[model samples]
Target: MKKTYLLLTALIVFSYTAIAQAVPAAAKMNQFIDQLMQKMTLDEKIGQLNLLTPGGGIPTGAVVSTDVEAKIKNGQVGGLFGVIGAEKVLQAQRLAVEKSRLHIPLIFGSDVIHGHKTTFPIPLGLACSWDTILIKQTARAAAEEATADGLSWAFSPMVDICRDPRWGRIAEGAGEDPFLGSAIAAAMVRGYQSNNLRQDNTVMACVKHFALYGAAEGGRDYNTVDMSRIRMYNDYLPPYKAAIDAGAGSVMSSFNVIDDIPATGNRWLLTDLLRNQWNFNGFVVSDYTSVNEMEAHGLGNLQQVSALALKAGLDMDMVGEGFLTTLKKSLQEGKITMRDINNACRRVLEAKYKLGLFENPYRNVSTERAATTILSPDKLALSRKAAAKACVLLKNDKTILPLQHTGTIALVGPLADSRRNMLGTWSVSGDWHHAVTLKEGMENVAGQQVKIVYAKGANISDDSLFNKKVNVFGPEIEMGPATSDVMIQEAVAAALQADVVVAALGEAADMSGESSSRADIGLPESPQRLLTALVHTG
Candidate 1:
């Protein structure tokens, strides 16, 4: 017993010695960034403050610049987004590391919001699960796929808390409740960033739409938001605070204004609330061209807003060129201090350093790994399970659920057969061809015992203009050559034949995402008509 005790004491002593001698992660990171920043020129410093998307995913506007490659080589571009595939990312990274004067590495980011290659349930759907661990696992799977594809950052975990269903962006957030939103936010941060940003398989998590974006007036997207400090602190702000507490590596400012000031240039919101009050150490990035849009907000011109954003604690300007073109001019005119520029630059560089970009520019990224990791069987299985769990059974009359393995069933609706819309919104990297439709899933599950009848009962909508708008990213909602009356008849015939009618009906995929808000949010006219016909056929 005495010998055992002595050995345990020795083990404890050794563990203490090891821990005490080791440099703290924070201290080590600070040291590395300090040395790196000391050698950087002012131009390179400002360059790090820019985040550009090189035209691949959903284009918010026309590609404004032509010389992206030249910009990277000249140290005017710090990161690239909307560029996927390992070979493509490698080509871009080579220019940054080999051709640039300082040979600094470039961080690659993407909007892997819900999932990367293996699409999961949408954020709102996932929220219904009320399973934080499951949500975290989804983010981890997304990170694995994204990092394999040569990305180190993901613009995700959009924790905006919105009660209004009319606001389309609510699809991208946890619904309505600040407490639930906060839990999901922390889980996502833990999943993406994983306790260590230096890990190869981990991507930095971004907590987004900071400071009451969800309360846009009249549920309009990118509209003004106004609230008392009491409501802001108690209800709207908790999720963002929770994400920060969970160690999110960055924040993205919302497009709307708070307290009559645009979030991109609001010093009180960005500085006092985020930095001083909450003590968030990570950098803040603008939402797509939000800096330039401040002119429309009646804030100022490009130069004025650019300087305003910088002074307000914005570290990265996304797709605006406001900072790239005007920050220098503002500096010369004494409109903005050199210290503000340096501080923003340092924050940007610090994020890269934390990501261990200096240690290995192409960390966890390779053509071989990229090919092997995405859409993996494990990821798909998780997604399937997540989808199943996310479905909240609101009611089941006469124990109707847990359907028999052997039965005649009718799957009728626009969504039941929709391959493109199954992945839902913001799954930009997901290939719809690979998605399993309800018909496919039903048949695969029930096998030969179950006879499944399927029909596109109706178009997602009768409105051609709305269909065109939704189909901007893809043909998620397309009108067939057949008339809507013919489609409804076909669906009614299928329903009459089946023992059980499973009518899947909902809005088109694009009906609930960025800039897709509806004044009257409901099922489209055609699909609703189809449901009515199916009921009459019964």
Candidate 2:
């Protein structure tokens, strides 16, 4: 037994050393970045900061962009976010490495929020279950599906400790406790990266909305945030720091302004704290267009804000070519140093190297493997299990749930049949048609003894403004014209005859995330009205 254990230890040490040889020395990696930068023009370098999403994997806002190929070939784009599927990712990736002049490989990213192909429960609900292992497993499965879809990074494990339920984006985080949030943050990092990111089926994890997007004043996303450093360290910084400690390779800055400065321009937070204090060796990327939004935060023009961000240690600017457009000019003007540009570029290149992209650019974009692995039954089974576990039994009055598969069940609401919303927020590349809605779950799980009666009780969301904002990603929530009176009459009639009534309720697709804040987060009027009607009838 002792000889066997000694032999295993030797084998493991040899394996780690072999893997270590693949990485260029820190100094050599910097030299490689330097040589590459010397050969590249400013526009080409700047193009790397622009992350665009073309609709395919998971939807972001109301719509996905249509011209991804042109942008990649023209060198106008740096990376892609909403695209997935191995073949699609492969096609997009080939455009960057082969078609473009720089031949730089594009990093494919996605929300991969819960289970990638297997729709896990939303993050907030998952956190409520207080199971860290389950959460990590969720991230592991997400990495597997995402890599299978040819993505290299995930914008996930949004770790901001939000105490206010009024904050709709809170549904995307660990919720209300920094201690718990920090622990979950570390677990997710471990899950996404595993012990070796260079290996197959692992994707880089981006600890996001860095600092405190969740602390949006009045619970509004992108609203200003002000808190003392002591408070930040004691309460909020832990999760971001925990993610860093756990080896998350990248961090995305939030849209919210911290103190008096927009996060994108906060030199103290990004430089002194993130790099110096935490000693985080990875790159920092901005949230969607956050660099441009600095203008809204009262910061100056694009050039000035972009310079400030680079000096402050921001490495990548997502969807905003602020750095690419202004950095060289700033370098000439002495506002920023070549060292700063070198550092940022080095960070980005190191990320690519750590992902093993140089060795095999198509490592994750395997078409044959994707066919065999993308939506396998095992993955689907995991999704169904995760969905079942994430369902919070908020109110199971009289033990009304664990609902025996026995009687007529009224499965109602826009989400009941929602093919798209099932993936939920940030699951940009996830396939909605693949998700099993409550209606489908009923058909699959409800036994032969049960009869299912369904209705489109109401739309997912009824607010015009909310619809406009959310519809930017895909389908706007359209209200049901089955009038409140008629829907109520129908619902009441069905409930009266049925053995049980199952009412599903929640936010419309667009009620959370960037620019999706809602001051009144109560159930939308349609469902609220429908619930009221059902109660009055009873």
Candidate 3:
């Protein structure tokens, strides 16, 4: 009987030890989050939400803050996006792991939409092909390049389904089909999070503009999203839900109000629907300054919006500082519980752990590894291949494109020989200097047989009102002094001289990000006017 008692006691001790760090990966995940949170302070909890700008902000210029270095050492930043390249990420990450109190590793993220070094077709245009395998391949390339850059996350596969082309960010997603969107969403998730989240070559994919930003009123950014529960379930929610089901590592809330409430504060949307209904295990992050914008939406002060967002199941705040500033006061005031804070912190830590940041601290980030993968000769070759593949034969009338190699091709317009504008919106991480512009591309294809003439046919648009909105992001668009007729005559004369007038044109980059949206989706009136003149003169 004494021997039996001794055995039972030993079994109990063994059981408790095993339960503390249980086997099976999912159970171990819970244990790891619990252990990490036990060591964290209230300050560190706030730090998780404070996604401070590492490079660029709304005024459209990048700020290389001297403070970012010190802040990371102090455990003030949870993660970073926008800042690319392996060296930058490694420097920032080292400060976090080597200098912070807890020594928690930082997760590096970027807008690796489509492809990273090898630029694929824009998401919207690519989706038109309806080939899931191609989309997956595009995502795979993005993952490879992103991981090569010391990144473990991508703000990509923006799965929002846009019904209207009028929405500027429509270029960033699949168009208007919930069924197709869901499939592509899963494909993207699989591609980005290949093998596992902890793999060095895999990066977490973020399914973004969540809970119906795409269906914004009149397709305008910052507009309201009003749809019945049934409508959402049947149409809008499927792709995001599909992304969650496919194990997407994170989600980004949109900049729109849902029903009568701002999405940043909607518990039914984020918590009940996303967490409880769909069973999403990953973290939820807000759009840029979206939580702060809730104040403008008449949702009370910053504290009130912050409380609302936290209660609604948002895990991280992006650029708002809403969660960073107000959660502690709310906790003291009996507004939010400790359980709430723990849940949020748990989600964020889970992501970092799954990225293998805690294990090796520099797993995918060797300088040599980054050099071998990023913009390698093969990757550049793939970029040209992707560019060629993405150049859709939109209007191949009389075989306009695949232009005759021997003919003189006139690449007329702002984008003709330009390097910067070849990339569309959100190309900050891309090496625009390397892009072969329309004229350059034409020249390369034609060899010395074709002469390419170029001109800025008209500034993005001649209308001053439209020009103002377009120019808000950058100084790229200049309001030309020439009258509409003068601009047209110039383009017409140039076009009439060449065998084929390749009028290089489109919305300039930065017209489709966040709040930089346009009401009119047509070609800028200046370009339209030029095209008309060119046809009439011929």
Candidate whose TM-score is highest = 1
The true-versus-predicted C-alpha distance at residue 238 of model 3, in Å, is 1.6
Per-model CA lDDT versus the true structure: 0.88, 0.78, 0.78
Candidate 2 lands at a TM-score of: 0.88
- Higher-scoring candidate on lDDT, 1 or 3: 1
lDDT of 3 by residue, 186-246 (tens): 9998989986778788999888977798998888876778888888889888999889999
TM-scores for every candidate against the unseen true structure: 0.95, 0.88, 0.88
Error at 210, model 2, angstroms = 1.2
Q: Give per-residue lDDT, candidate 3, residue 379.
A: 63
Candidate 1 achieves a global lDDT of: 0.88
What number of clashing residue pairs does each candidate have, in the order they appear? 0, 17, 0
Ranking by TM-score: 1, 3, 2
Q: What are the runs in model 1 whose C-alpha is more than 4 Å off?
A: 1-28, 59-64
Model 3 spans > 4 angstroms off: 1-23, 56-71, 394-402, 447-456, 463-475, 478-487
Lowest lDDT sum, 10 consecutive residues, model 2, at 56-65
Error of 2 at 298 (Å): 3.0
Q: In candidate 2, residue 182 scores what lDDT?
A: 90
lDDT of 1 by residue, 1-538 (tens): 9999999999999999878765586678778777877888878888888888778665455655558998999999878788888888888999999999988888888888899989999999999999999999999999999999989999988999897889989999999999999999999999999978898889998889887888998999988788898998889999999999999989999888887888999999899989999999999999889899899988789999999999999999998888988999999999999899889988888888889998888785688887878988899899989999899998998897888878799999999988888888887788889988888888888977889999998988988888889888878887889999999999999998888889999987788888888998978889989989998985
